[model samples]
Target: MKWTEVQEIAIQLSERHPETDPAKVNFVDLMKWTMALPEFDDDPKHCGERVLEAIQQAWIDEVA
Candidate 1:
């Protein structure tokens, strides 16, 4: 997805999960955390993939 779409999803997630620490909600940090997940460790493009998945999942979980 486009960076703009990713950002929009992140914002939606943040709004839904208001208890999450605001300091921890920025795009770069979230992408870093997602990339560190073990499941993506072997993927050569893990950083970008994880960032996209993280944003999407965050948005989904926010509403569920």
Candidate 2:
């Protein structure tokens, strides 16, 4: 996905999780964390999507 799309997704996630501070949420760090997850061990693409979803979910959980 494009950086613009990633940024928009990040913004939406930030809005969902006020405590996450999207400004401070480094995409690279998030990718690293997501890749480290056991569930993503088999697929890099899935890991990436999971990371994005996790970021969004974490943000939502934080704000909710």
Ten-residue stretch with the least lDDT total in model 2 = 1-10
- Cα error, residue 36 of model 1, in Å, equals 0.3
lDDT of 1: 0.53
Candidate 2 C-alpha error for residue 64, in Å: 2.9
- Candidate 1 ranges with C-alpha deviation above 4 Å: 1-24, 41-64
Q: Write the per-residue lDDT of candidate 1 for residues 1-64, one digit (tens) a residue.
A: 3333555555654664556764445656666544444332334244464656667665556555
Tens digit per residue, CA lDDT, model 2, 1-64? 3322444444444544455554466667666644444333444455455556556555555555
Name the top lDDT candidate. Answer: 1
- Candidate number achieving the greatest TM-score relative to the actual structure: 2
